[model samples]
Target chain A: MVDVVKFSGEKEKFNPNKILKTLKRAGASREQSRRILKDVESSLKDGITTKEILDRVFSGLRETPGIAAKYDLKRALMALGPGGYTFEKYFAEVLKHYGYEVKINQLIKGKRIMQEVDVVAKKDSTYMVECKYYNYPGNYASTKEAMYTYARFLDTNSRMHNFDFPWLATNTKCSWSAIEYSKGVGLKITSWKYPAKESLQRLVEAKKLYPVTVLKTASKFVKQRLLDSGIIMINTLMEMDISELRRKANLSESELKKAILEARQISV
Target chain B: MVDVVKFSGEKEKFNPNKILKTLKRAGASREQSRRILKDVESSLKDGITTKEILDRVFSGLRETPGIAAKYDLKRALMALGPGGYTFEKYFAEVLKHYGYEVKINQLIKGKRIMQEVDVVAKKDSTYMVECKYYNYPGNYASTKEAMYTYARFLDTNSRMHNFDFPWLATNTKCSWSAIEYSKGVGLKITSWKYPAKESLQRLVEAKKLYPVTVLKTASKFVKQRLLDSGIIMINTLMEMDISELRRKANLSESELKKAILEARQISV
Candidate 1:
């Protein structure tokens, strides 16, 4: 097997044999090796991890023109491993393409929320999306429960506390029971897979219109302080008067002031 | 609300209203309070703790005639919260009804394996069972990976590691598909949800044929242990040397001898 320079920014050309060798060495049988190699070679680029290679293959399938095979997303999700489902990953990419600011794994009160959200867009409102890749009939039950939980979560949270528009998105079919249950309870349900082609086109178009951006910038010292303190949300910092933020985050007053100043600079 | 002396050898009788009042005061809603009262009144005996009352209520519903209409098990399970899925509670009842000695939270080498199933039952050879309940569908994938990883576990620590079928128990469910996936895997999958009812009844009835003579001569302590261990399978115990059994259980030599002798004394 050729020794590959993995993470350099160069656009390395795809090599089928190199990919096959890697898969085979990872304990693939001949058939699996060839299949994975063919899938990876079509989208392989420099600096991509094995995870990226796999994701790119699946994402390519999603992008294929006129190839919308309404396959069970839950089955696809199962292949992603346990607890590997993240609506945030796809939504973040979509939001990035649409020019919205994104923050991930933002910590508050010493607890790391799984993710901050899809976007903290214009108008000071955060659009948080709860994604469900429901496969089995029973999967909808928990997905509905999560929607209720996350909605309640944001209602009282300091950061997105009065944020408008909590979006609950699902990639596969929601059970009729769950749909009716949610509707009866006045919970919003967004289906990326429903209402046929036009509905999907609108979502895809929305992503294009809203490309996400990382707007957060701070001084080197302040950035390092925030990182060390584990407070990643800007609003969380905003909620704290600089002194309190410093005391609770274990940051000195000078460090807190520097971070606040840097954030203000970026906003200006 | 009539007081009836429960099975605890106490003078106090059980009161349904009292149990309802306790649950209500603990923040249970009126509906929850009513259900708890009905469960306690119908199934519980005198002097039972609140915890025991709840456990018995749920356990009784496990086989109550058409109890699904009366109480939805899934909703009940969800209400128990995450840790409620542990082997210490529900799964133990499932194992007990199937005539297996249940042990929970057994620490081995300073690591708790959650539950180590010693034996499911001796149908020619004793079978071990492992129970896992996922809080989310995403959890299913990693669990499948771990189940696959148990291939190494089976090869190393199998009781029949040296000679096959000296014992035959599964390391994990044989396939990712369903509880019945072990049909042709040379190992049977004895999951909580998929036991054959007739076979279970047969086993239970057969065990009942040998009434353990309530022998007063035996040490009460030893007798209790023997009963707890389900000494009906005395022939299988004879097949196992006492020291080897004790070593597998990590018991002291004296304890091993005492347990085996006590088991021997109680049968026939």
Candidate 2:
């Protein structure tokens, strides 16, 4: 076991199973994963940061093209915006994919006022999820934001928007205080890395619902332009032929060829 | 009587007594108020805006030197500060003068988080006021703001901050929707002209607690500078000798003399 420093400053002996599990989740073959793990372990220095180790593993996944994209889901989710339906629409699609009837940016009329709810979904129970998307790296959602969002839900939840549950969905982690208060008040939250097996990251990975921005074949600038034009999901981009994709999104022939190749790989 | 259009676009026969009453309230003697009202009415045309009448009346008060300053109280309160104590300090002093022990910018700890309450006051009951000061003309507080404030109060009011009453104090009006929701949620509000008898303007005038910026004698630039330096109260400036006043505020000899003379006029 190699001694490693985690992101939170915890010193731990690195477990091969952890990286191996992630590699398997990213759809890399068992032999390919073991070989990459061996190469990483060979180069690892004791007390090296988890960040460094993850970066190495991330670059190592490029050997398999689309597999690396699946592991880069967190960045892709955060990259889901500044466009009209990239974040909220993406979340709504994810909800719909899970068999929940969904509404995006619905204007809700309460007893006294009209407020817009980001994503309202219902399955066994109705839930209104307020999406807080921030692009700043490592910026945790503040306690005030969680409280404010919950307060709006509470203020109007009395007679309108009759959501059985109030949930805050964010692309970033929430502050510890926000988490504690949210739990105390019964306001459920889903963030990039929170709530364990049901975190935003976990949910996306479990479902294999990768955003088009995740594809390594697409340049960041081209991906952003495509995202701007509202072609966010890899499934949507994969379904479009090269001519249709060119008509919808400004992509060069070579870029289109590579993107389609990776999209196909990811689809498999 | 003149047919005048008010700000709200209502056409009504203007009541001279209304202007007379405001003049009297501004500390003008009945005889002076009657003469000024006569001048204002003579100049008013049919379908004239209430704003035109108010402006003429405002300029009319300049002849009385300090009397116009009292009438300019609403603008003065709104003009309170871009400085440290200009708005919050002025409000705290106004509350303190009215027998509420006040704290400005208190870092209040809620059950799970520490939040800043703008002004916390204790009178017959403990109250926390969130002051929404907007310098823009006619910008009303929104329902979202009111709900967010009350939500924070509710979130932490169970154990800490101990505020028995919650208030959203603003320099501008609260939108009708905001007002209704705030009332529905039991969140009190005070704006420039609200609650009829005890609005911010009424409270300031009832105690003759005029800010330094209310002085028409001082140039707007000079008054803003003085407000920036925290010499906001005219009474404080009035009590100081001209040299001391000059030392404390960046007032020239001429400005100091005029400000003191007007301050004395209002003082009486």
Candidate 2 lDDT for residue A52: 84
Model 2: which docking level applies? acceptable
lDDT of prediction 2: 0.79
Q: Tens digit of lDDT per residue, candidate 1, span B58-144?
A: 454343212211222222232223442332344444445556565443322201112233333333344443345433211222212
Candidate 1 global lDDT: 0.39
Q: Write one digit per residue (lDDT tens) for candidate 1, span A1-268.
A: 2222323233444556654543443234577556545666655455556446645434543432111111112232322222323434544444544565665434322011232343333335564555554433223333334334343334324553444555555544555544543443344455544444423324544322111111122344454455345443333454477766867667677656655543343222
Shift in Å, residue A118, candidate 1: 5.9
Name the 10 consecutive residues with the lowest summed lDDT in model 2 chain B. B77-86
Each model's TM-score, in the order given? 0.26, 0.68
Chain B TM, per prediction:
0.33, 0.83
Alpha-carbon DockQ of candidate 2: 0.40
lDDT of 2 by residue, A97-126 (tens): 789899888888776677788889899988
TM-score of 2: 0.68
Kindly report the TM-score of the first chain in candidate 1: 0.36
